[model samples]
Target: MPTAAPLAPAATAAARAYLPALTGIRAVAAYMVCLHHFNPFAEGPGLGGFLHNLLLEFHVGVPVFFVLSGFLICLRYYGTEQWTGRWWGRYLRNRVARIYPMFLLLTTLTFAPAWLAHAPDTTRLWLLNVTFLRGFFDAHKYSGIPQGWTLTVEECFYLWAPVAFGLLRRRPRLLWLQPLGLLALGCALVLGLGPLAYEGLFGSFRFMLLYTFFGRAVEFYAGMQLALWYRRGLLRAPRGPRGLYTAAGLGLLLAAVLALVAVRGQYPYGQEAPAGIALNNVALPAGIVLLFAGLLTEATWLRALLASAPLQLLGRSSYVFYLIHFGTIKGWLRDYVTASPAGQFVLLNVLAIGLYYLVEQPLNRLLRAPSAAEPAN
Candidate 1:
């Protein structure tokens, strides 16, 4: 296999800059997750049921976020010559500031009803959720803000990313083996412990892919590899009419996932069965890579649509939206919007925008700001 050429320091620094197209893609992925949770087509039969079932698998959006997280983190921090204490501190602080504040606020609000009622085990659940360790255990995985399970996965990646980047930087050749190593470990868990143990401890081996860093490491590896290729200017989307071919390839990948889901019948994909995990963790990420490549390289209609101002704003506020969309606000408004999926969708986005502006954005800025007492280094 041909090794990738080493990236120049200048090229690496350029890669660290923000990619607006990625933010746009993030908006799409977050909305896909929202629609999955909302199940706007829950009421209708036939076409509606089919669409609902397909959207159920839109949980692929979570993996998209995971892969994107890996890519962005690698792009920014990989290949550093020195790992100084201050650098590590800044890294951890940025990560915590980006994720924790909103998560803590939302987790507290989600569990407040049960906590107030003195529900059994509520305190224990709160401990797990607040610490972002709920994903480690089956009982608490779905306890508070059920969707927050993904954050646990995100946290795991953040925890290990710096270490992984350091090792990869020291031994660039190891990059080729990392994904296979993760895949081998996943297979070992499945074959040795069997599927049940994998699911019980790690979440669904098939659906949630053990809900741990190790289980889903391949997705992150894929993203990291993409970041490397991107830094080298090796990734390119098809141009002109050929861009349609790239779109078609993505469509086919989605169809393949849908077929796998359909084969599972009532089980639904990514909720149970190893087949779901296989397709989701593998095929879905491939599709996302293709879509991302298209967005970056081609001036296709879909890219234009995603790059639009509204979607860009949606992308920017997506994290806040993901945190709160399925919680108290949805429950409170369920009665009025229960009959209209479209209305529910619009309401969630509107509420998300308000929260982003009023709460998330301001808090994020404040948290990221340097302390007055800390002199600039």
Candidate 2:
């Protein structure tokens, strides 16, 4: 079977051993981001009612992707990491094959129109976006693909995780230092670079805190910690309630959403507030880990729903869905395919699924195929 879109980056691998529910959750996360953009369910401008506010908070799905990345990466590659040149090459190639090709295609498509139209030279913008260097620049982060910025953070984590796992193997006591050090580095970057304002590189405390890996390292770490616990059999399901973790995870998730709504004073998102940042970066990730633990262990109906074959297919296609859900293709879908919002949504999913199977899967397999010097996993 084709490996699903790279979830670590916006998708994850069920390649080593597939988890049906987590695969389904990828569809859920991607769609949540889609709905945050489409927002047809909500009835308001900014945030009208409680339902609207809650839906607005669907942007939290970004953290869901982040957490899934951490969990799946550790689950698959934890003890397998090696310093051998071939092993490292295969690992990095697997990651690149999973994410980069389709991004390259769509990013070029996004800029091609502007270039053809001769609407201000955007060659630099194209370069930054194609390389994902734009993600660090506040001014350019949304220049090509708006949602692609998260990939920068995911890529950072991807590069660091193997080294981190190696270090943790040597000194298990230092696990807590990873995120703390990242947070400190984030602060340092803001203080050192914010005033200089070099193309908004680490421009503001808020941007660094919210957008970059430095600020949101906690989310990924929570997932890694959960995966480690799961691997060690440390996360035991409760005996009494049968659905205790599921219930608790759901409750915490709801509470975090509500808390964000409550603290969203004047700002567009609650995450802008310091308290809101804490809730999203710390509280929300904790909730997601609990939720994932429930999905992994508990035999809840929700898990059954998530693990269903159809949902799994959607999950498999979800990375393409995420990458094209916004920016250029979305506009193209609206213009050429269907102007109606619901129609556009249906068509969007159809196109994403098609691209995943037709374009992405074949290329991924080709890139990941073993060479003369390297062995396949």
Candidate 3:
């Protein structure tokens, strides 16, 4: 067996420090998802439909988040030889603190209007959304802030990551098997179980495979593989004419997106077709990987723009932006702002910034701080 190579000095430094570019890219992903939800384009022939199709396919942003999560988590914690109780406690707490507070607040606020109206099953809807289990049941999947479905998948990844890391560390060979196993499980659920299960259970399975972590494991694995390569000094930004690598990466990514749109078709645009899901489970992740590589490797104009301070701030506040954009403010401003895409974008950013500073940031700091009962090491 070949011994693993050491990371280069730059890669070593990157491993230790915060990757601002990654954060900035996250803002881009969040914005893409936001745009997908808004569908700002007017319907028409030729150019309008083309643009609309492109925006619809931006649902690929969710896979971007998944890949980033897998890469970052693996980069941070992959090589740990032991998983202590204290370590696990801290891990779970950090994950919960990072996600649950704002999620719960926003979810409740989102459902408040429905509850006040006494909509049918509003109580049950609130329960599912607040618990982050809405993704499991088709009926509840779009209950509160429809986008919250992605959080269910994220939570599953958070719970399973450490276990996956431990197993991979012990049996590195399983790296090849793990992703395949997940894909197989997803296929089995969608195919073998779909026909046999009760209606509700089958609906749950369909939603789970389409929206939850199991079907998306391949994308996460792609990211994990990237991290592994990065740690071993096998991955680097391309060193060449700035436009050369950037153009190449962009071309590949565009091709993937076009392929996805073509396979998925235009009408029922965002709905998952059999062919579309199968293609997206592979192609979309490939595009994201290419885009990520280009951003990481090339010193291009795009990189500079993405790494700018304003964008970084947007990225930092993106979680809040995502939570509130489609729910609170969108509903409030729908009539006034929906007609103007630029206006909607600007207002959403402003709202996200306010929410981040007022609630999410402070609460995050407080929760992440070591408890008074826990002695400072």
Give lDDT per model, in order.
0.72, 0.84, 0.73
Clashing residue pairs, candidate 3?
Answer: 237-297
Question: Candidates sorted by TM-score, descending order?
Answer: 2, 3, 1
> In model 3, which runs have C-alpha deviations exceeding 4 angstroms?
1-13, 187-199, 202-206, 239-245, 335-339, 369-377
| lDDT of residue 4 for candidate 2 | 22
lDDT of 1 by residue, 233-335 (tens): 8876655576864586478568755866666656745435556667766766677766666766787777778778887888888887787667675676676
Decreasing lDDT order of the candidates: 2, 3, 1
Backbone clashes for every candidate come to: 1, 4, 1
Highest-scoring model, lDDT: 2
Model 2 worst lDDT window (10 residues): 1-10
The C-alpha local distance difference test score for the whole of candidate 1 amounts to 0.72
Which candidate leads in TM-score? 2
lDDT of 2 by residue, 1-377 (tens): 12222234211233245678888899999998887777765556754566777777888899999999998887777776777777679888988888999999999999999899887857888889888888788888788889999999999999988887787777778887999999999999899988998999999988988999999999988988888887766778888989788889889998998999899888888888889999989999989998999998899998999899899788889999999989899998888878998887788889988998999989888887374122111
lDDT for 285 (candidate 2): 94
lDDT for position 260 in model 2 = 94
On residues 1-377, what C-alpha lDDT tens digit does candidate 3 reach at each position? Answer: 12224545655555565666678888888988887887878667799888888888777778888888887777765554245767678777777778789898888888788889989988887887788767766656776888888898888888888777767866987886886777677667667656655433325444655787887787888788777877776766666666554577567657766766777755465337667776567766776776777776667788888788998889888988887778665877777667566777788899888888889878877887384122110
| Global fold similarity of model 1 (TM-score) | 0.85
Each prediction's RMSD over C-alphas, in Å, is 4.9, 5.6, 4.5
Q: Model 2 clash pairs? A: 6-11, 7-11, 7-12, 8-11
